[model samples]
Target: MTGWLDRAAENAHKFAQRNPRAVAAGVMFSLAGFAATAFGVASPSAPGTEIAQQIISEDVQPLPVHEQLEALAAHQLELNRSTAGRANDTADRLLSRLGVNDASAASFLRRERGVRDLLDGRVPRLFTARADESGRLKELVVRMPAERRDQITTHFTRVTLHPAGHGGWKVRREQAQLESQVRLGSGTVRNSLFTATDEAGLPDTIATQLSEMFSEEVDFHREIKKGDTFSVAYETLTADGEPITWNEGAGHLLAAEYINRGRVYQGMWVRDAMGRGAYVGMDGQPKQRSFLASPMEFSRVTSGFAMRMHPILQTMRAHQGVDYGAPVGTPVRTVGSGVVDFAGWRNGFGNVVEIQHDGDRSTLYAHLSRIDVRKGEHVEQGTRIGAVGATGWATGPHLHFEFRIRGVHQDPLQVAKATQTPMASVSRAELQQLATSARTQIAAARSMGAVRAE
Candidate 1:
């Protein structure tokens, strides 16, 4: 008998090796029969088991890949039902621990219904529950929806639990703290202040602030010259030893200084009386002048004050002033503090304004389209007196700027020279000390390659 059983076992093993699929089917059928028999259900051979046999028998067909995927998906859905219910229960428990009542908890769950949409698609789903060292549920994360990554990330709102001493959790919005630093360098310009500031790594917002600071002295669009240069000290946003710049919105104007030509133009960021940001001079005065030095930012001098034949009139005219060829309505300014002595139309000089200064000095602006200041009105240095226009015996819109000494007309361009205010004797010592410190700082910055000369 033992020998016969061994031969049967060998034949079965060989059959399995030859037809693995049929063997697997037979094993499945045997498992089904055993399960029925073990459960004490009626067997196929037992009397009065016809009803059970009919119930168990069915016509089965092989399913395609798509159908098989659908079946697996349905089974996964059944499993996820329990998971989803558990998640909802967990969310409820979390909310309850956070002091939310039943009504509020329901509303909160409704608000988070979007989390359910994650399971409806054919994508893979992963659920992870995080716990503290004490095995308390600290967090639950359900990663899904590649497109909603950012949105889901934002939903990771934190709920702080009261110290373990307390019985429940206290929920609150989470916030992150940020800190930054900046180091601004300086540069010079041979053209416009706007262009130069851009080249110096300063943003438009900072450059605009700098322009506003010196608007009274420098006409950004008109008065800048080729030999004019500037120096600035400022700061930039930094993090982890790297500088940062924003493409939109004003970043920051830490601090800045500018020196145009030989004039020391300085400005620092400050809060105004109304608590608004602004740039003001070191002396707390506005850096702006009333008017600009020239009608054009950079233009060549075509005519000077001398005897010359009038181009259109065909007569030798004693040209008492210099001609600045600029566009129409180019502004004319008083070179120094003075009072308007005359502002009206003249026979040879079009619409003109004459400003009488101290020390028997005066200035005349002729061939103007409009006069801004009235006679007897006090005008400061660089104050706009009129607009350039061909209102008199002139050929084009150009400012006829004249300088006079005791009523004798002289060349305006040559008479005016760059002058520095004399420092008081007491202030001179302080200035020298400041200059020494500045030199040292500037030298160090240069050695470290923090500054570049023009």
Candidate 2:
């Protein structure tokens, strides 16, 4: 029997040498068949039977680990692409539903072009897939980066009807709870606020809110200067303590704190003394100043307040007020609280609004595209009275703002000052304690690497 086995092995080697490729294939097939049989093919009665029969049996075909992982990644990428496109579409629909005009939506989407860069990698993106009981995709979230999450939340800014004490439902503004942040390093300008805030981990909407907060004083397109720094703190909405993302529900802005060029500015969402919803300073005052430091945020004063030849008129004029060479409809605001004594078209002044304030103070706004406040109506400091226009004796769209004391014209730039709100005696004492606690809390938060939502 030993001699016969040796002879069979020698014959097999000779056959393999004659047909090397065929032998190798046959051996591989036999090994595979043996494995299938060992793992329990459909029919244990046949060990090395037909490959098709073995496959049809209970033998499971196991994929390699690496191939399985590759397949999973591909599947996830496909899902991400599909979800992202759907999210974009959903955003457009939501914007339309919220009454955002097509032009505005286009502009907004244009500004959000950075989203493409953010979705570069096959990163796992989480989005709230809102659906009915049927499990359909009702909404898809274009997940915002951690830095911009606060500003990109899915919140609605709506005007609702409130029950008036006398009769009909009066239109009132209401919003969902939302949070935003803005961070501007030193030596930055106002125009770049959005970009800077985005880097510092704020959302675009929050940056817009920040700009609006200081619109009366800072012109994003003009007024910001190098060496100017800013930071913001604000609130965002959450569910069960988890901040909601854009794919979730909406939120409201609870409060905000801003600091610019060493000056601290703050705002709180509150019901005013008249029960109207508004944002006010820490002292319950509006977040505004009498006048902006410069009409142009970054432009040098080409001309000062003095007697000079008018550029277009080419005649020597007193130039009573400062000329802010801004675009048409640039808002012109009141420097202080007052009543509009005059809002009409005047010779050499075009559309004008003359305000008379307490202490014999008065102000005049001329060359306006339109007047907002009516005559005899009271207005607060920084209230928008008109929009800049090139009317009457002007060469371009610019605000011709003037300040007066007892009817005597004064330099608007030098005359306007910020009125400070004095703390009450009791409140002052409480403030000291509050400040102490605040300092401690701030330190703790900093140590823990946590940012505050002011």
Clashes of each: 11, 13
Across 1-454, the per-residue lDDT of candidate 2 in tens digits comes to 1232233345455545754554544321111000011111111122232332323221222223224446756865422222322323444444343333344323333454533332333432333333333332333333332332223343333222223343322333334433321111111334466554554445444455556556555555554554455433333443212244443223223334444565655553332122123344555545544444443333333455667898878999877777777778777777677789999999999998998865446778778888899999999767888787888877777777777654656665544322222222223333333334233322222221122111
> Model 2 off-target regions past 4 Å?
1-302, 417-454
- What is the per-residue lDDT of model 1 for residues 1-454, given as tens digits with 9 covering 90 to 100? 1232233345455535754554444421111000010001112122333332232222111123224446756865422211211333455554344333344323433454544343333433233333433334443334332233222211222222222223333333342211122223344575666566666555565565556556556666566676555443333322111222222122334334445556665554432222223344455443333233454455556687666898888999888778888777776767778799999999879899988765456778888999899989998776777777898888877878887654766555534321111122213333333334333323322222222331
C-alpha lDDT score of every prediction, in listed order: 0.47, 0.45
- Cα deviation of 181, candidate 2, in Å: 49
Cα deviation in Å at residue 122, candidate 2? 78
Which candidate number would show the highest lDDT if scored against the true structure?
1
Off by over 4 Å in 1: 1-299, 418-454
